[model samples]
Target: MKAVIYGTALQWKLDLRSRALLITCYLVPLLFFALMGGIFTSVMPEMKETLIPSMTVMGVSMGAFIGMPTSLVEIYGSDIKKLYRAGGIPLGLSLFAILLSSFLHLMILSVILLVAAPVFFGASLPESLPLFFAALSIFTVVSLSLGAVLGLAARNQSRLTMVSQLFFLPSIMLSGIMFPQNLLPEPLILLGNLFPAAWGYRLMQGFGIRPLLGLGAILAIAVLACVLLWRRQAE
Candidate 1:
């Protein structure tokens, strides 16, 4: 399992170094979260600590749900399927490749936060550092599951990605990372509650350490991931 996680993670890092898949995964999501989100965060100090909710959780989830999965669909689509079979590797490898790539990108942006913590904002990590790490683990599972499911379902790469992005962007907006769920109109708040992002903020905010709907949500997501992955393994 460690090998699976690291192997997948390293390949993704290399791809960023060697490929054109920049910004969308690396720069854009962070920008959307940190910079774009800062436009709102700049006004709300209370919400400022919740930047990861907007940026990586939202941004990273997009990559996980769309980018990783689309790559799977593309790799498994007709011609590449034949080529991969001839090369003697399996479809699972393709899935792992894409997933690892998404996972690595999650870290790249988080690292920026680490570096920027002192330099840009003179901020130190909140006491909820444990929750922050827990949040990263949640990201890994969320992205992994979405990547795998979409990869399994997509007809082709672009088609899969387009569909994924459609879900991805809206998910970010609804995640309540940029805004709070309690403050939204009732309907929007209901919708936001359905996303991991809302839970993520609840977990990351000061409430992260306290028990509440946020803690319950995090546990639920973790259990859900285990169930889904178990199902996938059984298949």
Candidate 2:
């Protein structure tokens, strides 16, 4: 337990220095939130109510789907995996650490958006902060789990970027954040529903149990992918 704690701390410190991590996890998302928050609230005043949730969803998805995988690919596709195996360290430690770190980062970023939105853009807060955060936590986990699958599956950095965008772009463009899902064509809306970002956006709005189900399905698939990848590498 102590070792895990120490290792996670070290991982967090290393992540602080990573320019890519900083850009994706903090810089880009915050910038997007600031820019888009103003635009949405300006064009559609009623959107102020959902601005925080929408931007936070985009930030979390981007960090998890794009940033997390690139870091994981760098580790798993390099000498890091060999060192872990050589040292008898758990193969999943890196994954766990990265997910945890990403969660913390997302939470902080979410809070910033939550606070700043109302002050800067006249955005409204959620009626239930607890429920909002609970949903955010679930969504973050599911997002990172999907990212783990991508990281485990990609063989190279280029492929990782391509695949991450494949998931990230659809989540952003089709998710109700950019525009109403109702405005989208049926096929695109259906495709968006297949990803967590859509469910996550609804979840934040205090929707039904489908988001929980989506989280479970994504987590299961992520775990299965990791297990298979670990076994294959051990061979």
Best model per TM-score? 2
The estimated TM-scores of all candidates read 0.74, 0.95
TM-score, cand. 2: 0.95
Off by over 4 Å in 1: 1-10, 17-20, 122-124, 206-235
**Model 1 lowest lDDT segment of ten:** 206-215
| Model 2, span 89-206: residue lDDT tens | 7767777887788788878888998999999998889989999999999899888888888888888899999999999999999989999999999999989987889989989988
User: Best lDDT goes to which candidate?
Assistant: 2
lDDT of 1: 0.59
What is model 2's C-alpha RMSD? 1.3
Q: In candidate 2, where is summed lDDT lowest over 10 consecutive residues?
A: 207-216
Segments in model 2 whose C-alpha atoms lie over 4 Å from true places:
none
Tens digits of per-residue lDDT for model 1, 1-235: 6656664776676566743346556666656555655465457655545554445576567566655565556665547766766786555665666665666666666667655644554344656667676666665555566556656656576677677766566567776765555677888876665555566655555544432454356456655664565355434
